[model samples]
Target: MPPVSSPGLLDGTGALRTSVEERAARVRFRRAMALMVMTLLAPGSAQLVAGNRRVGLVAFCLWLGLLVTGFVALVVALVVALVHREWIFSMVSNPSLLLVLRLGLIAAAVGWAALFMDAWRIGQPLSLRLTHRRAVVGVNGFLCLSVMGTLLFGAHVVGVARDGILTMFGSDEVVGAHDGRFNVLLLGGDSGEGRWGLRPDSLTVASIDAETGRTVLIGLPRNMSSFPFRDGSPMAEEFPDGFDCDGCYLNGVSTWAQDHEELFPGSEDPGVEATIAAVEGITDLEINYWAMVNLEGFKDLVDAVGGVTLNVRQPIPVGLPHEAHFHYIDAGVRKLDGHDTLWYARAREGSDDYSRMARQKCVMNAMLQQVSPQVVVRNFEKIAQASTAMVSTNLPASELDTFMDLALKARGQKVSTLSLVPPMIQTADPDIPLVHRKVEQAIEQAEGGGTKAAGGTGRKPKATPDAVTGGSIGSLSEGYAANQAEDLGAAC
Candidate 1:
């Protein structure tokens, strides 16, 4: 019966038909998977419809000029973030425009992975079907390794943000904001191996305000002593009538300006410019910038932002009690880490540097209300590698997008604090006109005025059930409501 099948290899319900070179190798294996999906969607449209139209019009005009320059730089960074928002933070803190955007994202990730391997060699794939040339070489090696591994991981996160903004803002001057408020200072220092160089054991200023970022903070009292110096300042011609020489305090004015570096001649950090002229003569206020920090790399910037929720209200002691491995960061409202929040903002045995300056203003208001901006963009490269080995600053990288837009507008207001220490001001003779009239009435009640600022002495002291003291609940001679607060998170 099968011997009767030869009408041009039988058709109408017979067998043996597909022949012209096996139907042109199944239409060249479906045009090699439609030219690797048109070069994974228009990357020089599979070499302008099948290879070399002048190298597909120069890689389709550089991929349509990088998608019209990334949609005109996202519409000029959203119209310069609504007209002049610090010129888009001075063009992304320009380190020569982040080294030309990290060499144009590694030359657009090796020219879009060599145009997806030249659209898989114009999809000829040796006339297909060796399992369709191993499925077009596994879909052109997965679209050239997922578009060159997402532009080489965005050029390694823009070369680690231009080497962490040239290692934490190497300053190029820029000072600005003064009366409308900026202040700064901060400190904390405590260097190592036979100390000498940096001694500031925490000072604090952080004024802020410029336009309603209303901060305040103040604090100062590394055993503050007679202060003065800002007028004709070289530590005011060598402490005119103040830094009271007897192991003079306010953090030993940066080891007495690095032990007299010829009275700061062409100063390159004459001990942080003599501790910013003794914190602008003990807060008569002008300073503008300072920073310092380094408290043993501040516990790797508090374990790189993953550990800071305070309210311990008791058991907080970690080391110094003749430390033979002394511990105890017990009490409640937990989340400590970073060696127990740096020994609960530096625990002093039975705590009293004004209850460790009211537990360092409840750890700077719990790291400015739990470090938000999505925990700084999801732990931004481990908080820029623990802030370049824990901070140091002149504060300039063109004012880090104006203090990151005044720390996101002072995390929705209400910070205010004062703490010169003691029953209102006398860290051994620190009543410098009552610490500059409680720092101009806590910057006139944080700019709006009248809320009984400077730790509102409008009486409200009673609540002391657990009576903790050193770890701080009250009693360092009745003060630590976060040192002085109008609302330092409801006085911690």
Candidate 2:
């Protein structure tokens, strides 16, 4: 009161007001930063340009480092589990118990958040200053870093979510094959079985040659008919005994299995094996192995790879009924995640099952290309985990490690994907017909010199078709060339 010359000078209310404003500004800044991080991380990359790139770039690097470290830790745990043959969840379910460790991690995260908050404030001055080019650059750089960091963090989290230290396969069971060429029939079963609410949407047989590292895929259309399962009684045994065929339709196979579960429970081997036999019969290629997976598994696999990059011949649209109906796709190359991938593989719009098979082959190629040594090394745990429910492979768990090692060596190799359909081979009707002779010829070609008779001009036709379709041997090769043949020999 004695020195109350100016209330503004001596009164603590002015100071208190300033403090309150600062606190409010900080709170606002922190919220904005948090929101920005969340936005940049979720499902898209547009947030990269939200602020200055310098800060963004720094954040991106730090996030990447964290991802690498996390991946390595996960990988080591997986390796241990693989060697020991343990469950992956053994590592995933536990949160470290040490309070000090948890507290330290929280501190680190808070400190990191604080630093970003300060950077954000620095980029925005409140002096009524005009926005300058440097300010804009700073803001953009910061945003770029944030966005990239967010993406990297997201990637890491996805990886962690998909993998763990304990493996589904035990150490005593994980084995690898050397110099062994294996054929895996990949079935994308969608039948409303188990947790995944659909039947097999796509079925592909992949042949991996360990020696040359060459992979060959043969896609089977769900509608293609032939090689009925030993029952002359009628192929539609699944549906009230004659719902469809002497030679079962692709979908009928699953139905038959469901109907006959009482006869064959604890295993759907006979039905799947029958399908394998049908494809083998059609292609004239022996199936060395098989892997049965579903659409959900396929989604998880695509996601595990961090989204595969494919050169889409068309922009496949959404909301189409999941069936054999034809659909249209806009031509272009793009990266697709799980959701888009399902649509892409199932898009038979404006076309037939043949076209759908082609798209499936494209997806397979993209997967092969995207899966690298680095990717495998980083995602081995994830690969195994995601593969658990989705895959039913004949390769024994004991040999899985060997297979992985050999597969790692074969990364980036070219894969030849083919399908049986019109042009290369034709059906009695556009929808159904089984290839008996033509398929034999194609199998011979796939085996070795079988190609000479059916392929090389030097050799004559292996065996003439009983009924020639307009001077062409209604062969599987013809079917593949006509409906399939997109980017035939490009390496991923």
| Candidate that scores best on lDDT | 1
Candidate 1: C-alpha lDDT: 0.79
Tens digit of per-residue lDDT, candidate 2, span 1-492: 455434324364345233554565565554444544543352111124455456556666665676689799889877876754223433332233223334544544443554444444443545312334345345545765665465455445444433331233322333233225566677776635463312356777665665545555666667655433333222324333222456656655656665565655455355665565555545555665566676756778777777877665434665455745434334456777776777777754444565566666667666766788578657655665666655655654434444554454445554554555555444323322334444433333444544534332122222343412211122333333322332333411
- Pick the TM-score winner: 2
Cα RMSD (Å) per model?
A: 18.2, 13.2
Every candidate's lDDT: 0.79, 0.51
- Quote model 2's TM-score: 0.51
Per-candidate TM-scores read: 0.39, 0.51
Name the lDDT of candidate 2. 0.51
Error of 1 at 116 (Å): 1.4
- The window of 10 residues in a row where model 2 has the poorest summed lDDT is 467-476
